[model samples]
Target: MFRNFGKRTEKAPDADTVVPLWPQNGSAAEAEPSAEDRKLSAFLELKSRMHEALIERLNLAVIDKVEPEELRREVASLVGDVLAEENNPLRADEFRRLVDELIDEVLGLGPLEPLLADPGVNDILVNGHKTVFVERAGVLEQTGVRFRDEKHLLRIIDKVVSRVGRRVDESNPWVDARLEDGSRVNAIIRPCAIDGPSLSIRKFSRDPLTLEKLVAGYALNAQAAAFLQALVEARMNILISGGTGSGKTTMLNAISASIDPRSRIVTIEDAAELQLQQAHVVRLETRPPNPAGGGAVSQRDLVRNALRMRPDRIIVGEVRGAESFDMLQAMNTGHDGSMTTVHANSARDALGRIEQMVSMIGMELPLPAIRAQIASGLQIIVQLARLADGQRRVVSISELTGLEGDVITMQDIFIFRRLGKAADGSIAGEFIPTGIRPQCTALLEAAGARFDRAMFLPEEA
Candidate 1:
C-alpha cells in the first residue's frame, strides 16, 4: 500500500562518481600522515573505519588520499569540507615539483615538454600525437617521444594553452602559447585536427647565436663576410633565401653585424629570434590571442608600427606571406638597408615566392608593377643552403640590377662554386667574386663608408 504523506528514503553513496583530479585522466601517490597522527589517534581510527565502510558500500574510499604537497592545497580544497580534517602540509618546493609530476603524468608524451629542455630544437611540429617532429640545424627530424594516447596529450595541451590563457576543445580547438623558455607553441585539437591533436613549438636558444660563432661554424667565408659587411654599411636592402634547414637567419645576422653602430634597428618577428648587438636596436615580437581569445598582434601590424617609431633599418626575421609587399613598400619608401630572410630552394625561388606573396596582398597589381616593386625596392638576394654534412653555406650572392620590360633583372656579384674537397672530406669551395662590385658601393661611399678592394680578401673565410 502507498502512504498518503510524502516520504524520503536514504540514498546510497555513488560507486562511480570517483573521478580522478589533476590529470583527470591518470596517476598519483598516497602517503600516510605522521606516525603521531596515524597511530593511537581517534581521528585516524575514525578515518580508517569510514574508509572501510565507504570502500565496502560505494566501492570507493571516502577520501582518496595524497601527500599534502603533492595534493596541493588549492586543488585539495576542491574536494570540499569532506577533507577539512586534512592538514595543509605542503612545502613550497615539494608542491611545485609535485605539480610538475602531475603535469608530466597528465600530459604523458606531449612533445613540447621535452622541447622546452632541448637547446638545439629550434622548432617542433605535430600533425597529430602520433606524428611529432622538430627542427635541428634548420632541418626537420621526427622525434621518438609521443603521447600515450590522445587524452594523455590533451592534458598537457590544456596546461600549456591554459598557462598562455588560450583554449582547445570541440568548439575552438586550436591555440598558441609560449613556453617558459620563450619558445613559441601552436596546438590544434580535434574538429580542426584532421588527425589527432597537432602541435608545433618554435624553440628558442638560451643564448643568441653570434656572428663570430657563425664564421667559426663555416656558415660564411671571409670574402663573403667582407662583401656583406660592405653591403650593410652601404644600407643595401638584402633578402636572404634558403630551403627549410638553411642558415638564412644566421647569415642575415652575420651580415647585419656590419651595419654601423650609429644607426637604429628595429627587428620584427613572429617568434623573436634575432639578436642584434647594436646600441640602438629595438626588438618587437608578435602576440597570439589571449585565453579568452582576444588581443592578437601580427607582422604587418609590427611593420606599420615600426614606421612610426623612426627606424633606421627594419629587420624582419622571415617573410612568409603578404608581408612581402609591405616589406618591399617599406624598403622603397625609406627603410633601405632593411634585411630579412625567406624560405626558398634557390635565389630564383626566393624571388618567385616573393612574387607569389605579393599577389597575396589582395591587389590586382600587374606582374610588371610587382616586378618593378621588386627591382626598385630590393637590392640583393643572398642564398644559403645546407650541405649533406649539415653545413650551411652561402652559395650565391645576386643583385637586383634593374627591370627588363616587365621582368625583374638580376646580376650575380659573387658566387660560390664547389671546388674539389680537401683530403679530410671537409668542404672546400671558393666564395669567389664575379668581378662586378655592386653599384651600391658608390652609395655607401656617399654615406661616408670607407672601404678598399683588399678588404674583400678571404682571410675571414
Candidate 2:
C-alpha cells in the first residue's frame, strides 16, 4: 500500500465540486507548481488504491471513446467519490491532479510522459527506480521523476520493448529498440544489470537541425559548409568519423539533404533514425534474432542486397562490422555518392578501422589490396568531436588521395585549431583551411559544383 497524503491546512469548499485553481483572467503565479508536479504528488496518494474495485469499475474501452475533457471529468468524479469515502480532504488542485495521474498511468508511460514531452531534454537515463537523469544540451542533471519500484520500471521497459515486437526476460535480459518518434532505447535488467534495471533513451530532435543552423551554431564555418555541399552534389563517397555522442549521424543527416531529389537513395541502419526528407529514399533496418536465436538479418546482408536494388546512393547509418567490406564494394562498383559513419578519433584512424573490419571477413586479402580498395572507394572523411564544454564541432575534413605502397595516403583540407579554454570553460577553436587543395577538386569542377581554390588556401596565404 502507498503512504498516506500529508495534511494541508487548505481544503476544498465542497467535496463534490472542484474549481480551477488559476485566476479567472488566466494569470498564473510565478511560484505555482507545474501540472506534472501536482500529478506526481497525487499519484503517490492513490498508488495503494490503483487496483481497487472502484478503479476497475471504470471500463477502459468506454474511457477510450470519451473525449479528453469528458474523461477527466469522469475520472475526477470517481476520485472525488473515493476520497469522500475515505473521509480525506483535498484542495481543488489536488483533486484535478489525482484525475490526471490516473489517466496517465492507464494511457501513457506515467512518470516518464512529462520528460519525454520536454523538447529541451536530449537523453533520458533511468539508473533505477528512484533515480532519473536527463541530458539537456549535452549536460546531465538529475531529475525528480521516479518509478514506484523496480517492478514498475520493469513494467514500463516491457511495454516499450513489446511495442517493437521485442521482449526482455531472464534468458534475454537486454534489448535495443526505438520509440515511435524515432528516439533510440536500450534496456538491461536483472542479473545483467548488477545494480537494478537500467534504461537509456537517446532522444531524437523533433525538428532536426539544418546545415545553415549548424553553421550558425559555429559547428563549422561557411566555407567548410559550402565545400561539403559541393562534395555531396558532386556525388563523392564520404565517410564521417566520430566518437560516441559526437553528432556524426546529425552531421550525416544534414549533409544528406544536399543529395539530389531525383536520385534513389537507400539508407541502411540497425535502427532506422535518419529522417531523410527526399522523395526517393528507401530506409532499411536490421533485425535481431528471436528468442530461439534464428532468422536474424544483419547490416552486411542489407548492404549486399541494397546493391541489387539499383541505388544511386547507398547511405549506411554506420559501418561497424563486415558490412564495411560490402559498403566499400558498393562504392567502388559505380555507387558514387555513397556515405557512412565510423567510430574513430581521426581521419587516419577511420581508414584503419575499416581495414580491420574488412579483415574480420576471415579472408586472406593482402594489406595493399585492402588499402587500394579503401583508397578507390572513399573520397573524403569528415571527423567530428564533442568538446569539453559539450559543444560538437567538425574537427577535421580530409581527402583520401590514393594508396602509397601499403598505406592509404590522405590530406586534410580543413582542421579545427584549438586556441585555449575561455573563462566559461568553453573550448575556443577556429576551423581553418589546411592549404591543401584536394584532388577531388577536378571531379567537383567536372560536375559543375566547383568552388574557389582560395577556400582551401591557408588564412595567412
Candidate 3:
C-alpha cells in the first residue's frame, strides 16, 4: 500500500527553516558575533527606523480607544509595506520578530514588555535607560534588555503612571501606581533619582498563592498552617510581621482565604494589592493629593470609613503610619477577626512599631496604654523572613500573653530552626512547634473549634 516518491535523503535546510539570528534564549549571550550577527545588527537598525516611521503615522492619543487586535493587523500591514520598500533580506522568523517588537513599542512598555510577560520573574528593577535587573527565585540578575536612551525610558514611565491617573515630572519626581494586572510599581525620576529615573515593579501573580501552595513550598509546616486556619476561623486578630520583600502580603492573602465567606470584610491599602476571596468584601485605597495640594485621602480616612460600613473583619495591606491606631481600635472594638501586616524583624519589634505609629497620630497615650491595647487586640503574630539563600519562610509564630509590668510579653508557639546552609546555597531550616500551646486555645474552643493537642508538641531531635 506504500508509494515511494523518491529515495529518502538528508538535505540542507532552506534559509527560512534555519535557526533565528537572535539567540534562542532571547538574550545575546555570545561575546563574539558570527557572520549572521552582522545581518541581525542591520535588521535591528532598520527596525528602529520603521518603529519611528510607524509612530509618526499613527495618532497615539487615540490609540487606546482602538481594539488591540485591529491595531495589530493595521500595524502589521504598514510594517509589511515598509519592509517591501526597504527591500532588506530578512528570514521569515526575523521579519515576524520585528513586527512583534514594533507592536510592543507602539502599544506597550517597549523594553519591559517581554520581562513583564515572563512568569519566572518576581521583580523588575529598572535602574536607568541602559541597565535592567530582575529578581527570579529571590536572586537578582542583570538582563540584556535596554532602552534606546534616557528619553525612551522616561516615556515608558510616563505611559505606566498615566494609565493609573498619576504623573511624574520635574515637580512630581516620583509616583506609585499599579498595572492593569495589579503589579505594584514605584517610580522615582530626575532630581530625586540622582543618576536617572529608577522604577521598581513588585510583580503580582496571576493566581494568588494559597495556604496549601505555601506549605508545599516549605514556607511553613502543616501543623502551623492548621493552627493558623483555626485562629482565623475562631476570629483571632492576627498581625503579619516581616521585612520588605519578606512575603508578608502573600501570607496575609493565604490566611485571609480562611475567613468566613458570609462575613463582610473591608480591606484598606495604599496601592490596593490585596486579593481577598470572601464573597462579601469591600476594597479601599488611599489617594495622593492633587497638584494644588487638595483632595488627598489617607489610609486612616479609609479605615475610619470602613468602620462605619459594619465590616465583620478589617484587613489593611500594610500599616506604615498613624492608621495603626485606627486599625487597633477596630480590632479591639468588636472587629475580632481583623488582620493587617507590618514591616518588622520579629514579633516584639512589630509591637514596638505599632506603638511608635500610634504615637505619631498625637493621641497622647502613655506607652503602657498602647502596649495594653496591642496585647488585648492582637492574639497572634506571624513573623516571616527571607533567608540569605533567597527562601521565604515563616520564621516564627507567637502569641501575645499580655503585658508583664508595662512590657508586652509574647511566647513563641512555633519557630523555624535553621541547621545551616545546604550544598546548593539554600538555607536549610526546620519548622518546628515550640511545644507551647497558645493561650487562645480556650477562646478558640469556646468558639466551637477543635485541634489536636499533639500539634503543639515539639519534635524529637
Candidate 4:
C-alpha cells in the first residue's frame, strides 16, 4: 500500500505522503527524469497500479470463487497498460526485461529476491543505498546493490516486514521478522537508526556445521579435533562459550558432531542456528508471538519437551533466558553430553553467565545452587574468541571440576598461550595443553576409550 519512499534519514515524512520516488540522478526535481530515473519511476508506478488491480480482481474472484488467469498474462496486461506500450513500441523494446514487479509481489517472491532464497548467505545487512553486506565463509563482506535512495530502501523494508505478517512503522519503528526461508530479520527505521532504514538478517546455513569444515578452518588442530570427536561419540554433556561472533555455534557444532549417529539428538534454539550432522537430529525453533499476539513457543518449552522425547542427547543453540534452568536440569538429570553455548568473555565467566541466565528463568534459586547445577551438568566449557588480528581461535578449553561454595571451580585444560607476536604485529598463540589431565576424559576412558594423548605431546611427538 506504500510507494517507494527510499531509505529515510533522520525524519520520516509527514503521514499523508507516499514516500518520494528514488532520485533518478543525484537530484529529485522529477524533470525530464534521467534515463535510469525514468525506468525506476515507470517501474514503481506500474507496480503500484498493478498491485491494486490484482487485489481488486482477486477480491472479485474470491466472491465468485473463480480461478484467475495465468500469472504471466495478468502481469503482462497490467504492465502494458501502465506503459501504454502497445502504442509505444519504443518503450516496449526498452522494457523487454519487463519487470512484473507487482505480479511478483502479489503472486510470489520478486526479482533480486533470490538472495533471500539461498540459505548460505547466512546474513544480509543493508547499510544504505550503496552497501549491502552478506555473511559468507563465516565472514561479512560488502555486496553491490543499492536502493534508488532512502525512500526506496524504506519501501523495500516495509514490503519485506509486511509480508512476514509483522508490522514496522512510525509507532512501531522497529520490527523483528522471519523470512519464508526461516532467516531471522530485524529492521529499524530512521529516528532510531542514524542512517536510513537499518536491517540485519541472521541467516542459517543450509548444510549446518560439520567437523570436517572445522578442521579445515584450523578451529582446532587434528588431535584436539579428534579428541572432541571421540568425546561426542561418548555422550559427554558439554558447554561451548564465547563472546559474540566468536564461532561459539561453530564450535558447538563441531563438538556435537561427535554424537553417535544412531543416538537421538534434540536441538533447540531461539533462532535455530545449530547445524548438526546427526541423522536423528530433531531441530526445534522458538516462535515469536503472532499478529494477534498469541502462540509463542520458547526454548525452555522445547527443552522440557525434548526430555519426554526420550532424547539420547539434547543440544540448545544457546541459553539466553530461563531456558538455562531447564537446560541445566536436563543436563543434571539424565542427559549426559547434552550441550549448549553461552555468551561470556572467558571460561570462568561462562559459569557465572549460566548462573545469571538460569536465574533469569525466574527460579530465584541461590547463586550457589545454580552454580552447582552448571558444574555438574556441564563437564567442560570451550571458549572461543576472534582476536584483534582477525583470526578466530580456541582461546581456552576448561573443565568444570564441581563447585566450591558459591564459586564454580574450573581448570584450563587447553589455553591459548600468547607465545608472542608475529613479525607483522599479529598476535601469535598456540593452544597449549595445560598438561593436567582433563577430568571429563576419565569418563571417556571408562567408556573403553583412550584420549589422543600423543597429539598433545610437543615436538617429541
Candidate 5:
C-alpha cells in the first residue's frame, strides 16, 4: 500500500482568475490574499501590466543565447526599473517574485515550473489551460496551477515538442517527448483532443530509486531481490510485466543495476529513460518520422543494429510492437542477460502479448515455435502491480520452464498473496515463496552464482 510521505497542503487557485504572485517570505496577509480582496485584484493587474512590459523590453533572441542565471538577473533588473517608473504598489519582494514568474513564462514552462520543482509530485496533468492535476504519492490531486488560456497551454506544448525535434500540428496533433530531466511528456491538441490541448507529464526523480530502497519500501521481499540479482549475475534473460504506472521501468532499472559492469549493454527505447550506471552501456532512442513521412528510426531497427554492435546484453525499455521479435532474437542469440519490460496484467499475459507482437511482424511462424522461442529466450518474468492503495509491488515472479506440448509452462517461484485492506485502505499482503525451486537454479549455479535453496521453501514447508 502507499506510504504517506506527508501530504502537501496547497490552496487551490480559482480557474477564472490569475492568482497574485508573492514572495515566499512575504507577509502572510500579502501572500495569502482571499479571492474577494480588492488588494488581490490590484496585485494581479499590476503583474499583468509588468509582465507585458518585461516581455516587450526583453530580447527573445538574446534570451536563448544567455545563461539562465544571467538572463534571470537581466530580467529582474528590467522588471525592477519598469516597476519604479510605473510606481508599483507591491513591495520589493513581491516585485521580485513577479519578475521570476514572468521570466519562467518567457524562458521556461510557464505555470509548470513550480510543479516540476516539487519533489513530492510524480506526475503533472494539464487538462486544457483552466485545469491542472498532479499525482503525489500515487494519488491524484488538483493543483492551483493553470495557464492563462488554451492558447497559453498550446504554446507550452509546442515549446516542449519542438525542443525534442518533434512536431504536433493539425495533421499530427499528438506527440510524445521527454523533458530535459527525462520526464516523459505526451501532448495532444485540436482535432485529436476535442477538449482543447491536453498534456500529461510523468516526472522522473532526479535521484533514481535503487533496489535497496525498493526492498526497504516493501516493493519486494529481500529474498526476491536476492533472487533477481542472482538471475542477472547468472546471465538469465528476464521479462518484467506490469500495467501502466505499475513501476515496471523502475523495477527494470533496479534489476539492471545488478548486471556486470564489464559487459557491454545496449538499451533501446522510444524515449530514453533508463539510468543504467554501467560504463559499457549504449543508449539508443527511436525517432518519429519527419514531415515527409520518412527518416523514422524505429525500435525494431535499433534492436537489429544493436546486434551488430556486439553487445553482451540488450535491454529494450518496453516491447510494444514488432520489436518484440528482434528483442527475442537478440536474447536467444548469445545476449544471455538481456532484459525487457512488457505491458501486461500477468506473466502469462506477458508471454501472450509477446506472441501477438511477434506475429505482427508477419513472420508466419507457428504458434508452437513462437512459444518455444519465448520460453527459451526468457528465463523469468517479474510481474509488478500498483494496488488500490497506490502501493507498487512485485505481484509474481514466474519461471519460464520451457514449452509443455503446445503451451509454455511457467511455475511461480514467488507471489504476493493479498490478505485484505488495512484500516487506512492500504492493501495488506505478504510475499511468499511457492516452495518450488526454479529450474534455472541449476543454470545459476553452473554460472558461478550461489543462491540459497531455503529461499524457495514456503513458510508451511
Candidate 6:
C-alpha cells in the first residue's frame, strides 16, 4: 500500500559542515551563535531534506488511513535507510533524537512536540520561527528551540489550525484553535503580526488540579478551600475574576469538582479550555465566521442555547462580551449553580466589567437595574492574582450582600494580606478570614452543605 519506498540517493552535508545558527534575518544585536546552536541548525536542515524525500517516496492518499504506530515504524525504517545511504556519522543518541523529531515533523507539531510533552511547561509562546519561550513553574524562560524558517513556521501553524477546522491566511490572518490534547492555541500571521507569525499555546493538563491539590500548593488555606467547596456544594452562582495567567481557569476547574455528578451541566467557551470532570456535561464552543464571513456562532448564542438544554448548572469558560448578559440571566432565572470567569483586577472591578458587558447588549437598562440583576444572580466572587514572585493565590473571596439602594454591596469573607517580601524575593502573605459571615450561610446550610462558622472568624495576631 506504499509507493516505491527505497533508499534516498541524495548527498547529505558532512557532519563537519555545520554553519553558524545566526538569526535568519541577520539581526545585528543578537549574540554570536554558539557551537551547539550551529549543530542544532544543521540537524534541522538535514531533517527538512529527509522529510521531503520521505514524502516523495510515500503514497500520500492512504497515509491518513494508517494506524499511528504502524505509520511510525514505516517512517522510521525509511529514515534509517536514508541516513545510512547519506553516511553521516552520528552517535546512537543523536540518531535516535533525529528519528523521534522526524516523526514529530511528520505527525505532530514539529518543534513544539517536545515542549508540549513537558508536563512542567504550562505555556508556550512562539514569537516567530526562531524565538520560542515557555512558562515553567510559572516563570518564563527562553528555550533553544527554533524552526527552519518563516515558511516552515507558517506550515506548522497551518497544520495546527486546519486540524480544528479553522484557517489562517492573508484573508483570515488570525485564528484560535486547540491541539488534539486540548491545549489552547491562538495564531496570528503577517500584516497584523508586523514581524512574523505569532503563536501562543496554553497547555492543558491531563490530570486537572483539584481543590485539595490547590490547598496543598498554598494557593489558598484549607479553611478557604473548604469554604469554597461548601459554596459549590450549595449550588451558589460563582464568578471567578482574575487577570491573565492568574490561575482563574485553574481555580474554576478545581472548584467544579464539587458539582454533583447527577447534575446536568453545560459549559460554553470560545476556545474550549475548561476541564470539568462531571459525568453528565455538554460542552459548547463558539464558531468563528467562515472565510466567507457566514455561519459564525457567538458565545452569547451558546449561552442562550444552553439555557434550553435543561442544564442544572451552566459553566461559562469566560464572559468577555455580550455573553455576560445572557450568563447573568441564566443564573438569575433558574440555573443557580452556574459559574463563569472574567478578566478583572478585583471582585468589585469584576462586577463593574460585567455591568459594562451587559450594557453592551444594547438593552438600554438602567444602572441600578443592571446592578440588581448582578446582585441577585452572583453569590460569590473569587479574586485571584499572580504575585510578582510568580505565585498565584486567591486574593479574596467576597460575597454579594445584595444592593444597598443603587449600589451593589459585598463583604469579604476571606482575604490574603501581603505582609512583605521575603529575603529570597518570595512573597509573604497570610490567607485570613475577614470575620464576615456571608448572607448565603443560611442558604448553604439549607442545602445540606457543611458550614463552619469558626472558619469565617478572623485570626488573632
lDDT of 3 by residue, 136-245 (tens): 99999999777766887898899998987888998889999988877899999999999899999999888899999999999998889989999999999999999999
Candidate with the larger TM-score of 2 and 3: 3
lDDT of 4 by residue, 158-235 (tens): 777777566777666887766655556788996877777888877655666566776676666666676677677677
TM-score of each: 0.66, 0.86, 0.88, 0.73, 0.88, 0.90
Which candidate leads in lDDT? 6
> How many clashes in each structure?
5, 0, 0, 11, 0, 0
Candidate 5, lDDT over the whole model = 0.87
lDDT of 1 by residue, 307-384 (tens): 899999999999888888889999999888999999998888888899999999788889988988888988989998
lDDT tens digits, residue span 120-156, model 2? 9988999998799999877899998888779888988
lDDT, candidates in the order shown: 0.70, 0.87, 0.88, 0.71, 0.87, 0.89
lDDT comparison, 3 vs 4, better candidate? 3
Clashes of 3: 0
lDDT of 6 by residue, 279-395 (tens): 898999989898789999999999999989999999999899999999989998989989999999999999999999999999799999999999999999999999998899999
Where does the lowest 10-residue lDDT sum fall in candidate 6?
A: 1-10
After the best TM-score superposition of candidate 5, give how far the Cα of residue 235 lies from its true spot, in angstroms.
Answer: 1.0
lDDT for 145 (candidate 6): 89
* Global local distance difference test of model 6: 0.89
Q: Tens digit of lDDT per residue, candidate 5, span 1-461?
A: 22222233275544564443433455666766577555545655665676688778888877789988888788878877886787755677887778777878887897799999999999999998878999988899997676766877898899998888999999888988989888899999999888899999999889988889998999988888889999999999999999999998889989988889999999998988888989998999999989899999999999999999989999999999999999988888888999999999999899899999999999699998898889889999999999988899999999988777989999999999999999988999899899999988888998987578788988632
User: Model 1 shows how many backbone clashes?
Assistant: 5
Instruction: Write down the TM-score for model 1.
Output: 0.66
Question: Number of the top candidate by TM-score?
Answer: 6
What ranking of all candidate models by lDDT puts the best one first?
6, 3, 5, 2, 4, 1
Evaluation by lDDT, superior candidate among 1 and 2: 2
TM-score of predicted model 5?
A: 0.88
Candidate with more favorable, higher lDDT: 2 or 4: 2
lDDT, residue 67, model 2 = 89
